[model samples]
Target: MNQSFINTAVLLTAYDPPGPLNCVFFMLTFFLYVFTILANLILILVIYMDSSLHKPMYIFLLNLAVNGLIGCSAVCPNVMDNLLRDAQSISYGGCLLQVLFINVYASSAYAILAVMAYDRYVSICKPLQYHTIVTPSRVKLLLTVVYLIPVTLLSFQVYLTSQLPLCRFVINKLFCDNLSVVKLSCVKSALGDLYGVFIIASLVVLPFFLVLLSYIKILHVSLRASKESQKKALSTCAPHFIVFINFSVSILFSVVYNRHSTVSKYVNHLISAQFIFFPPLLHPLVYGIRTKEIRRSITKIIQRGILAGPL
Candidate 1:
């Protein structure tokens, strides 16, 4: 292979070569992509159309659905395109752009979950002051921080990555990630290493810690409250907890598997794809089924559609 081609386009050799199996994989993924998009879109539209859900909690849910859509869009189309092509590769610029959106999607996910945790904490622990603290302006500021932090931090990460000269062209994964791109650098970058550590600590560790703290406080308060209150709190926080745990565990597996992949290539691919597959598909479903208000809204909409059918 030519060095220019290697440098200009990184081959993703993680996937199986194009064949009947690959075609089947493509069809499965295509359906998943469609469902993921429709689910998130319906979640967003439901929240938007229902004035009753205009409150802070549902607003945060809407933000999450939008972020899921961004994350899903960043990877799915590219994956499908590559699956159909003989050479599964991505251009240098395109790889960086995918890295940017994916990193934003990931970092924004934890940040948004952290914000949601705090929202739950305030609502459960301080009901009287919930409206006062989580006011409309406050929610706007929080959402801004959710995207702003990820974009600023991950953009710097991608920029530093882009500056490195590549001595490697093939990525051993299904998609381009920052770590994979940085590993392709010909020389070691001390500054990039330090910044990478800083980003992991600030973006991943901190948000998880905040979520833990919020839940602890919520638990403490719930223990002291009546059974009815406890039930209410559990119902309210269950979906968020489920969503957070599922995503965090998937990401943890991906990181661990990438670092020490003793498993077969197919297993590694599936493990890595979990972060892309499960969260976007599951988040809206979890919230829609578990949350009474959203579930009720969706039911009403479906019923109305059924009743309004040609007669």
Candidate 2:
């Protein structure tokens, strides 16, 4: 550990909302944490237990649920802990660990979403070669790339950020993120800034572009196909698009709220809080409700439980 890091702590100023709002936030966080876990676990179990859902798309969705669990687990506990405390804060080491997992979760989401878009493109646009192209081994490779790239990059990013000596100990947000942590350093690092830009571009912007390209091609192919084929395309693509959009809007709005000084402090906290809260909950609900296969599997499991009980 660096000398600067010794006995260091960062105050989460935004966590200290006034009056009954604190209790409201606590109850809300607890509820979200419980439900998010159950929802994501159910999604994962449904996909794992059902052999029909063992396809590349469902596999990706399973990982997405797993990622949501990781993200919410990283965030919600810390948030709940802070909300309970009079002096809401996190130790430097704890904050960095939280930063790492949250970044990995967020970045891998975009990467996986991009890969899913490609999977859909292959399925719809190149149906004949879909199985050949998206083989099990290849799916594993894509997943490996999706997770490994962000973990490696964000690990390095966190390491670089850690080395910097922070002049300030207060982060005016619900939790510590890479940008929020980086901004506290007394000495600005040009390399860190540049690399941060590169990380955003590669993990975020590039995946977004890839998703757009894949969907554009899918749209082109769907337009020329029969009505039934178009409906099939819509059915499969709608859930993923909805998930991607929901996550994007939450994150984008959080960023906007953080950067805008005119926004109220509590309002900023509330908006930013959704970034951690919504995406995890939304993932399973959208997939479980929207995707027919997963929905059927969930229904079957529920019915079996009910039927297994004594009349």
Candidate 3:
């Protein structure tokens, strides 16, 4: 690519159209984006509007839903637009914004999941102190930190990336991912790579262990409780665990796929989309199926909506 044109905009490909199925695949992508957004929105509003759900667990659930919404919005619309059109390009400024949103939301999710695990532990292990520990004000503070840490850390990442001079402008993937954007730089910054590893470890590894620790304590306490209590704890925490595993696998695939560029470009494209596309839909689905309270609330709301509609 011409060096002079690098500053103008970067051409991003959705997936190297591997076959003659571009129209059908893009259509599936568009509908999936729409469905994911709608399902997560429903989940969020159910948690918000239902006064019965105004507790610590549901509060964190709300945060998760919001993360789903913001994260999907960050990357999906751009992907959909690119897939529908003949050309796929994002301006330099817009690309930076995409990188910022994608990282911030993705990072915040780790924090929120950790918080949710802690919420579960307190509720199951220290029932008496659960209310005192996870108060509305405290939850507000936790969410503030969740979003704050990512934005602060990723801003530095973007700053380091911005400092690099780019002579290459083609991004091989669908959206402006942090690693992908950084990879385009003519000279790779050692400091940027170190910071990337640090923040990733901080965001992902630490939180996963924290969640694991909370669950361990929860399991111990749950075992000591009565059979009914054990079942109840399992019912509540199982869904969160499922979501955690689902998301962890997706993040792992993205990390592995990016690190190993020997993977086919079309294959990388599909794998990258899995992380951005699947979790939001999966979060609501897992919670809705596994959590008794959420299921009842959803049913009540849907029945009301249907009853209130025109005959």
Candidate 4:
């Protein structure tokens, strides 16, 4: 074909060209995505099915699992499909929807973690007042905010980002990351960057600080307790600590690397995967293995299933 004809044909193709190591990357990511979904789903199911788990902490965890599911759903299928297929291009509207959900999921996850931290704080620091402070009504209110705040923030972000003119249609990462998409715009507005930073600070940074503060107070309270109480406090806070460390490290590395090196695209991608996928994958294992309650609940459920089966 002539050069012009070839170029036209390429443009007419629905997807972008696959990367050189597409097969390997796709398989690895697909496995991790499956693991993440299954782990989070199992945890959610376990929490919901067990009447004993219908408490404040588990409720927050269930919320976290739901958010993780939404996040994985938003990014993984498209990424897996792109990796498997020759066509990698996403429609403009589809890209925007991906961006919106990713933001919403991320923000919701943070908010839920914050709620979990507050639950721990109330339980530990105000033992007598815990029931009144962290009631069912309060949990509902917190969950409502967690779900609504992200939707509001991302709506504004998507609206602003969609207005910017695109110089290039190629997005480097697997999914439509807000930063990567914004960087592609021909007109990079300070307003957009500021808004992005504001959202990051409020959603990610602020929650991190609050979690830290809550844990510090929790530690102090635990120190004053008897040995048994101290152990229980530590156990309750342990999963949150792991989550906080994983999330904070990922976010910190991403922010620092993005600021320092223009060629840190690959590093940013790794950080993104760690941020979204690792937590859900590891959360169940961490909590399940460490907490007797979760382990016992799972065992009981399995035992009941076996007893009820035809075989």
Candidate 5:
């Protein structure tokens, strides 16, 4: 099992039909890609330039927007291109890069969200110590860890996948995914798939559960506070909830669909689209619409052309 086998391996046995569905998919996904890029970019710009948004929560949101941009970029362009050309072929190297970027972006976003949950916990659960615990230096350190850990983990994942002998590089979804690539391996892929499962469990499921628990505790504390304080807490956490739901649903659907191909192809396609497009498109909107500071900042930027320096 080596590169030679990969060269001769028939990874994709069938060609995807260029039907009305594919054309519709192409148009829809192309529109989504444009919207995702524009929305996330606007959020990033607003966060960076808004003086009022110079807080930990907004910073976390900026991080999320950045991650969403990277994630969408990793998948959407290639998907749009393939859809337009009726091409489903992906080279082994290209597939590996896509997997690596997807993992980096998705895992980093999860890490940042976990940090945000902790931030909210400290603010709501330990208000007296919130400032001390979540200082600018500590926030910077946490963000660094959020990004670095994902890069390290994804590097190892890509290295491991590269070592495997690819039989065919045809990924079923619009983009290259880790599981799909592993399924194409000529050799036994149990180890690689097992590692992938571990990565998903640790990076995705465990953190999400912890975030949910933290929010539950935060909500309990918030309910006991004054009405003004409760409103403020909800305002801060609302955007995070929106982002969490969007990402979680997409990931859950993708994982479930990966387990069974006998299911309808259209169902898988829908899940894949959700996983690829929804986060990037909605993340910015969630934060922008839910956070007044962000909305004001965006308006100020549009009107004044320059208000504050970069973040």
Candidate 6:
């Protein structure tokens, strides 16, 4: 609808779209995406409205929820559409947009998670100085950088992929991704490949290392303190670790499954679907249940809703 639909030369032909039980799959995926988006949206709303959650940790959590909302929005509708149609394809611009949004989601997750770990470390290891260290201005600056850097990097990726003459247009997966687009390039781009690795290292590996270091420091300080301090630190960090482990493992599986030559199509499809689908759904559950403040906030909102009765 926006600027004529320029169909790409490549078509996305796989989604098991014409398979039997499409209705079942459609309903399942449709509701899942809806629930995922709703949960994250509500989390963002709660954090934004509640003055109690204006601190750096909650801001980072809000960033994560926003990422989930955008990421799920980027991939899920296409998936549900493909489930109902025999021909699954997207426009060239559409495909680039999808890949860019997904990569932005991925890159932002890393940056936000790193910032969160640093927040936790500051709170746990330097409690007296936490306010001085992680002030509101600092949080805003970090948040802006985390979001902006990813968008800029992924935009460059889209530019690189666009320069390539796509000799082939059929992407076999349920949705578009950067790697899939890169493979369609008429010429294998050594520079693009190198830059991609660099981006991955910058966004993924470095962030993971930083988070690890923060946790190490947190652990060191927490163990030396009283049982209450240790429990407090664990409670705060466990939800984040759960999210980190879940996403890292899911992405790892997706990467390996995609790159491997011998994976069954059905299995590859499932893993790929899970990669984009599950994180958004899981985040709210883990944090809403595990984090006491968020849990209490959700509970109060539910109580008020019940008290308000049918509107």
RMSD of each: 2.4, 1.5, 2.8, 5.2, 3.7, 2.5
**Residue pairs with backbone atoms closer than 3 Å in model 1 (clashes):** none
Best by lDDT: 1
lDDT of candidate 6 vs native?
0.84
CA displacement after TM-score superposition, residue 54 of candidate 5 (Å): 2.0
Q: What lDDT would each prediction earn against the true structure?
A: 0.91, 0.89, 0.83, 0.77, 0.78, 0.84
Tell me the lDDT of candidate 2.
0.89
Tell me how candidate 4 scores on lDDT. Answer: 0.77
Clashing pairs in 5: 11-168
TM-score of 2: 0.96
- Give candidate 4's TM-score: 0.88
Candidate 4, 164-244: lDDT as tens digits: 776666665667767766766688789988998899888878887888889889988888889999988888888788876
Query: Least lDDT summed over 10 consecutive residues: which range in candidate 6?
Result: 1-10
Candidate 3, pairs of clashing residues: none
TM-score of 5: 0.88
Residue pairs in steric clash, candidate 6? 10-169, 11-169
- What lDDT tens digits, residue by residue, belong to model 3 across residues 212-306? 99998998898888999998998888999999989989988987876675766677777866888899889988898888899899889999889
* Candidate 2 RMSD to the real structure: 1.5
Give per-residue CA lDDT, model 5, range 1-311, as digits (tens).
24554333222323256777668877887888889989988888777777788899888888888888888899877776666564566667767778899889888888888998889889889989989999999999999998887788778887787788655555556666776776776887576778778888878887898899999998888888999999888887888887887788888777777666566777666675567678778888877788787777878777675544442
Worst 10 residues of 3 by lDDT: 1-10
Query: What's the lDDT for residue 241 in model 6?
Result: 95
Query: How many residue pairs clash in each candidate at the backbone level?
Result: 0, 0, 0, 4, 1, 2
